[model samples]
Target: MSETNSAMTLGKRSLMGLVLGLAAGGALYFVPECWLRDDFLINTVFKIVGNGYLNLLKMTIAPFVFASLVMGISSATDVRQVGRIGIKILAIYFVTTTIATTFGILGGLILKPGAGLSLGTFELSGQYEAVESSFADVMLGFIPTNIVASFAEGDMIHIVIFAVFVGVAMSLLGTQAEAVKRFNEDFANVMLKIVNMVISTTPFGVFALMATTVANLGFGIIYTLAKYCVCEIFLFFLFGFCVCGGIFTLLARENFFRFLTQFIRKVAMIPFSTSSSNATIPYSIQFCRSIGVSNKVASFTIPLGATVNMDGTAIMQGMTAVFVAQLYGIDMTWVQILTIVIAATMGSIGSPGMPGVVMATLVVVLSSVGFPLEVIGLIVSIDKFPDMFKTVLNVMGDSVCTTIVAKSEGEFDREVFYGRKAAQ
Candidate 1:
């Protein structure tokens, strides 16, 4: 009861934060040019608050993920059991991803979102230094040459690789690695606490972020890019109903609508509102636990889902790649379609769980097919709103994947899933 109340309080605070931020942004947007157009007072204050919060968030991701991942892996399963669970997880990921991208490809062709926008090309302001990473490079990149350097640079995939080895070593070392595992687990808990503290200031951060957005580009950009929302929504639900409802719920023999409404929709609102997967992890774990996932399984799968599973973002990539192509008047070829599937899949894996992360990942996909960087410029301006939905889908996908894995491992409780025990 106390825990539930705490969650309610937290949710209320976050909702208040969103409302306050939106109000401030609206006020800033409506200000007269002569009075406050270029005035740095409001802009300057919010920028510092907002950007500082963002930087603080950026600082936490690599370390938090590193600590939690190592702890989760070390504690979750025995070394021999890792292969069975790992293969199943990976297989589910690939299969569902195929469904996602297929939905994207067919949706892009049929729906033709962003088809007739007479928008000018805007240059994407990021350096995509053309470096061809072959399959060999990708395979080799997993093994960090210098573990210290990987940590310093915050290279997550590399960190994930390194953490796995450490975890395996810990498992082998048994008592020798006990202290280290405890330290990591403690460190992870501390990081999560810090994240909640940081998130408490999200109102101000969101205020400045939205304010900066509207001040520079104006809401007209949102209007212009509205079609992208249509595309994303279409794909989000299409995937949601079919893949989530069909593949996960139905196959599991759980009531489809009940699973969507009862389990997912409740917690999914967090990521949708906050647009941060890491922030949503606590709620996600709670929901999964309430549904009867074992603590170890929930702990491991939730963090791993944040790190690797990105069904939501992948769907966006498929559609966005096509949208960019349409903006440039380029008809996508079959070869390019295949390339997009590959790039989108890989990009989803590499994309971090942060604000504006999908944008960073869109770069990888765009560059893979030789899509003009300038197309990114036009699309980036209106990325904020779309990103919220993208995150909802992303986190929802993670929850689904985690639940499925728990079921396979027999870590899930059917009684809890259907709330039979709770009824007692």
Candidate 2:
């Protein structure tokens, strides 16, 4: 087959997989009692296929992250440039994350969706133990003690730091590092290929995940959490369209909606299905680069953004805290709300990029402010929906941050930023 034809074939297969997966998931929801009663079916086929896909995606994450970071760092001309870019990226990430948390708090305060609601006795699982490490210890730990352990434990932050060091070291060596640089680049490309191969099955993964969630939880949960879900979605649109859009417009002096048009479909899909900023990193990179952001900006910012900056998660944490407070008839002072925002922002940064991590981290943040865990437990059962929306916002924030940084660095194509499509 011609290369073009082969690519098309793969695209078709991916789409077909998504449809089949969704269909299968939907079918499971209405399956006969006997089929549903089979514990093996639930534990084996349904759980395995859905959860297994997530595990496989996660399995590739460490290598992909490190390889991409190595490739990004090696491509940098100097440490000074890397430092400048890194600082800017982190600043944007921190500021926007803070804002996201604030936005959630504001939304929750205004909406008060959980007012007068009572979530009676519930048990919270997965208690997170605080790592006794100090700030210095946390910083030091960013350098992997053992590379293999970082991957085994899914330590994204450590892997990212290690990749950056390798990249910078390779750049310092110049031509002497040619072979290593070439090797890292080749390795990253190969990993990306592997990622593509795995992501082709995303439809199936989404289907299984959705079906299992629907069957186990049922639509009744949505009705119960309808107000909460509505409030959360409102925050998603408000942040994505208003807050983030405003930032991009002020910086680029362009229409934010127009800028979003080109990549909305691509960015929106990953979060809805995968509900992970980390899983969506590959697509975010592709989308940013396509829209004329330089490799330097996209590579450094997007990956780091995925790790440290999750606006959606931040927003969810803040709002959920307020919701819990309201549910328990606990009136939070301004001081308490401010503390929740700070805690949520910090917790999100420290949170790992995995399913259930954000929810757990939010619980930690809320608990710090004396919010009830029982309410958090109720939120957890219906987290998948908000998770999807939050992932979308997180990815969108990354893209916006990249665009602004690229523009400031003179690495952005104004035409493309305002253009109808990303550069080919």
TM-score each candidate: 0.60, 0.59
lDDT (tens digit, per residue) of candidate 2 on 1-424: 2433443344455445544544554566677757444476666776787666655655665676567657654653344557777767777888999999998998999999776545443333222223244556534544568978766765545555566678779978888999988887888778766766665565455555555544554544345467898899889888898889899999866667766887676667866666667777888888888778887778777877776788988988888877876665666665566557766775566344545446435544655554554344345445656677787788888899888888888888866665656575
Residue range 1-424, candidate 1, lDDT tens digits? 3433443445455445545655565666777764355557455676686667666665666666566556655653343555666666656765676667767877877777767653455443222223455666545645679988877865545566676677667767778888987888788778766665665565556556655555554565345467777777878877887888777765455666766776555687788767677777888888778777777777767766775677877888888888777765666666567667866765565345766545545655665566654344334334556667777777777767777887878877889777788511
- Please estimate how well model 1 matches the true structure, expressed as its whole-model Cα lDDT: 0.65
- Note the Cα lDDT for every prediction shown: 0.65, 0.67
Worst 10 residues of 2 by lDDT: 122-131
Backbone clashes in model 1, listed as residue pairs = none
